[model samples]
Target: MAYWLFKTEPDTFSIDTLRLQKVACWEGVRNYQARNMLRDEIKLGDEVLIYHSSCKKIGVAGIARVVKEAYPDHFQFDPDSPYFDIKADPSNPRWMMVDIEFVRKFERIVTLAELKAIPDLENMPLVKRGNRLSVMPVSEDEWQTILHQE
Candidate 1:
């Protein structure tokens, strides 16, 4: 199965929140490229690195699995929702989301600073300067390397 990394603001939805909910709809992705990855690449059973971004100590916090395929993000249709998109139509949605189930939280946070220092992770998108994709593909080697750090 394909591997991926999905970033969320810890204050918004942390690994603790995922453990409590068990499963969550990964929505509110506004980037076209990120949306396409969810719509076309991710599938049920795929593993994902749950990352905490836009916060102190940004890095991979836990593991998750894709529990549901791509579907229209309901928030995009709600006028009151912060993620609502006026251009999105129910019949032909402009944004898509997936369901992710909590797997396990890392014993220690693999901080972005730590990742940046690792030569093996040098090519990782997360380590790249100014890279900002919320959802990104991860190679098997990259996944293994990061998990091994735990």
Candidate 2:
């Protein structure tokens, strides 16, 4: 299966929260590029690196496994929801989500600062200038290298 990196703000939904819940519906993705990756690329049984972004010590905090394939994001249909889209209809969704099961938290965070220092990750999108896709593909080698940092 393919490897992926999913970014979340630790204060909002940290790896610790995922560990407690065991599984969660990864929702609220409004960016079309990130939405496409959720709808088209991510699949059941795929491995994911839980990247903690927009918080102190931003980094890869843990691992997760996609337990369910892509499905329409219900939040898009709810008027009260922040993720709601007024133009999105029940019959034709404008967003999607996936269920990911908690796998394991790393012994220590693989900090972005450290990631940038590694030659093996030079080509990684995470280390690329201005790259901010919330969900992005990870090469097998890159996945292994990041896990190794723990």
Candidate 3:
């Protein structure tokens, strides 16, 4: 199964929220590249690193698994929702989402600062300058390395 990292603002949708919901539709991705990843790359049973971004201390907070494949994000059809898009239609959707099931929260947050200091992680997209994609693919080697790091 493919590995991935999905970032969410803690204030908006934290790891705690996922723990409570058990499963949730990962919606509101606006970037074309990120949307494409969800649409084409992710598959059922894929592992995902649930990351907390755009917060005081950014890090990988927990683990999740893809439970549903790509589908139109319903939030785009809701006019009252902050993620709504008038341009998207039910037939030809401009946005897509996937369902993820919470796995486990890390004992300690693997902070971005800590990740940056790892030589092997220097090439990671998360540590690169100006890199802001919320959903990104993670290499198997990189995935194993990060998970084993203290």
Candidate 4:
């Protein structure tokens, strides 16, 4: 199965929230690249690292598993939704989403600084400057490296 890193604003959709909700639809991805990953790449049974971004304490907060395959994001059709798309047709959607179930929160967050320090992890997209794609592919080695880090 492919590995992935999914970035989120902790304040908006924290690992704690995922734990509480058990499973939730991962939506509101507006970036074309990220949206494409959701629509075409991410699949059921894929492992996702939940990275907390746009917060003071940015890091990998937990793990998750894709429980459902990609499907049209219903929010795209609702005018009241923040992610509403006027150009998106119901018959042919412009946005898609997947359901991820909570796995387990990390005992300690793997800070970005720590990620940057690791020689093997230096090539990871998360450690690269200005790389902000929310849904990104992760090499299996990189995935295991981060998981095994203290």
State which candidate has the highest lDDT: 2
**Candidate 4 runs further than 4 Å off:** none
lDDT of 4 by residue, 1-150 (tens): 999999999989989999999999999988889999999999899999999988988889999999999999999999999999999999899999999999999998999989999999888888999985999999999999999984
Per-residue alpha-carbon lDDT of candidate 3 for residues 31-149, written as tens digits (9 for 90 to 100):
99999999999999999999998888889998999999999999999999999998988989999999999999999889998888989988889889998699998899879888986
lDDT of 4 at 115: 91
For 1-150, candidate 1 gives per-residue lDDT tens digits of 999999999999999899999999999999999999999999999999999988887899999999999999999999999999998899999999999999999998998888888899889888898786999999999999999888
Give Cα distance to truth, residue 70, candidate 2, Å. Answer: 0.3
Model 2 — TM-score against the truth?
A: 0.97
Candidate 1: list runs displaced more than 4 Å: none
Report the candidate with higher TM-score, 1 versus 4. 1
Q: Estimate candidate 4's RMSD in Å.
A: 0.9
Q: Which pairs of residues have clashing backbones in candidate 3? A: none
lDDT (C-alpha) at residue 150 in model 1: 84
Per-model C-alpha lDDT, please? 0.93, 0.94, 0.92, 0.93
Error of 1 at 38 (Å): 0.1
By lDDT, is 1 or 2 better? Answer: 2
